[model samples]
Target: MYVSVKGGEAAIDNAHRLLADRRRGDRSVPALTLDQIAEQLVLGVDRVMSEGSLYDRRLAALAIKQARGDLIEAIFLVRAYRTTLPRFGFAEPVDTGAMLVERRISACYKDLPGGQLLGPTFDYTHRLLDEALDGDPEVEPGETREGATEPVSRIADILGGEGLIEEEISGNDEPDDINQTPLEFPLSRAMRLQSLARGDEGFLLALGYSTQRGYARSHPFAGEIRIGEVEVEVFMPELGFAVPVGRVQLTECQMVNQFKGSAKVPPQFTRGYGLVFGQSERKAMAMALCDRALRAGELGEDIVAPAQDQEFVISHCDNVQATGFVEHLKLPHHVDFQAELGLVRTMRTQFEQAESAMENKEAAE
Candidate 1:
């Protein structure tokens, strides 16, 4: 068994070496640089950064490359590296309202105040692959048009003016950090959002989809989905001022769900918000739906599905924990297997002896 373990360790080392060779491919072809990955595979890098809860684009790109483009693995790498870094003081909350709007669209209005600026979206593009991209691609400047430089108005704000939506409270309560503290249910709104932000994208996507398929049945509309860069500020204790730390690309989704009035309250449009660290629209949207569904109790809606269950959703959402447990099946469990084997064998022997005794008694009779 020790020999087998030693052999397995050696095999693992060799496998890593082989993987590194494969990741680099041939010497003749130039290796892909981190900058190239950061620029070209921006979406993937964004996902890794968002899930990893870190915003370093270069690190995200490096993780992606090291993981051989496996996004979940890349996320794991970034997250593991993040734990070793020293924690400086927390950054001040960003004001998304003041974001430099790149792509802002509202499903609620035909034309918003600034009009719809469809910036760099694949919404209308054909799904066919351009063969020109297979070879060395040329960097060319595309046509740029001047549009709304004015700050885009939010659809939720318009609804709020008419008292059609629930009132938003600007409370000064500090948000709980689940990363620092262990999780206990039922989670607070802040903790819920934090958990979802770092939760597995695919898991959230599936749960969000289940709601759409009549599981929880929150009639949702994408009120607004905005993608842009927001300036991050950190509060300096000594300076007594919040200074601009950096800028990060963000995808924010606000979903509006139709809700009927309860016995004591008037009907209004409810909201679910999703904000991620990078250009992740689908993830943002999925997160929004799941967020709303999780708030079914707060909204006075009946909780009828797994998505609505707080414990079910939050507990199984983390990919790292899930993957670790699932992959542990690959490890040696000979002792465990032997225990089960012995129990089964003992039971079988007892059954056989009892059957033989019964047969002898019948013959004598």
Candidate 2:
């Protein structure tokens, strides 16, 4: 095999130009606008924002257009672009508790303090193609659903009061972000959650389902899942307070799990948590289960399987990293493979000769 030359850069450039030409279609045809993509393919934009680790729908749409609808590539574009942008400040974590919530429901409660609001969902709608969208018809959504004044408290609050489950966020202290720095060996709650948020939806879904299939089956009820905009504020030491820096759309899920009798802990309910960048309740729910399953060791439960091991799950979670490395094997590896093949042949020949000599010696004896 010929030793490869490093013409990858030139090839990549040409490929990029080809992609641009294809995405644009005929030069005579109009190019699709970011707004159009954002409006028409909103679910794509949502997935990009959700998995891309970005909160901006417009930016996700732009990335999707630029990547020619390759979602993973679009996610990479968003992540790369986001790094260069200067941080203005952090926003106050919108008290989703005090949120002007859009959707809120509980499997754990009959009725919650903050009434359930099924704001905007296609949950019950049959997934039939509306031929109406075929024609160039312009339409607008109607007025917002009038919501309740009160915000909902978690159903786990009932269990928490009765001391059935361990508490969640420690109100007194804030956790550091894994993105702010590289993670060391052991991880904190913030770091673990951060890794899972950026992981692939399908991967998380599989891991979560494995638990139900007895891989680490811990029964969990969807305690509450909500999707909406939350106000974020960064603490300003100068002002000695956190100010509103921005708003981010988010999906959050908190699961109430049945924790049966273990060695140290009694039979009680526990919690699994997930918070992501956009309104993806499915991802959030799956993430919460996986998160709890990964916490098996710390929770003093059985760490019998890969899914139960925190290091195994979190280390393999990031799709961008995983996909890139896995695909790299597709690149030219002739030199490496040839060397390994030569070593194998040499070893086989030596083994055959040695066995022949041993057999002949025995015959001579």
lDDT of 1 at 322: 81
Candidate 1 off by > 4 Å: 1-9, 145-149, 350-365
> Which digits, one per residue and each the tens of the lDDT, describe model 2 over residues 29-67?
678899999888877788888788878889999999998
CA lDDT of every candidate: 0.89, 0.81
Off by over 4 Å in 2: 1-3, 6-10, 26-29, 87-89, 138-143, 148-150, 169-174, 261-266, 347-365
| Worst ten in a row by lDDT for model 1 | 142-151
- As a TM-score, model 2 comes out at 0.86
Per-prediction TM-score to the true structure, in the order listed: 0.93, 0.86
Per-candidate alpha-carbon RMSD to the true structure? 2.2, 3.2
Best by lDDT: 1
- Candidate 1 residue-wise lDDT, 1-365, digit = tens: 53446658788999899999999989999999999999989999999999998999999999999999989889989999999999988888887887777888888888877777778889999999989899888868765447534467788999999999988767898888997878888888889998898889999999999999999968899999988888889989899999997888899999999988788768999999899988898889989999999998887778999999999999898887787899899888887888999999999999999999999999999
- Each prediction's total of clashing residue pairs, residues at least 3 apart in sequence or on different chains, is 0, 7
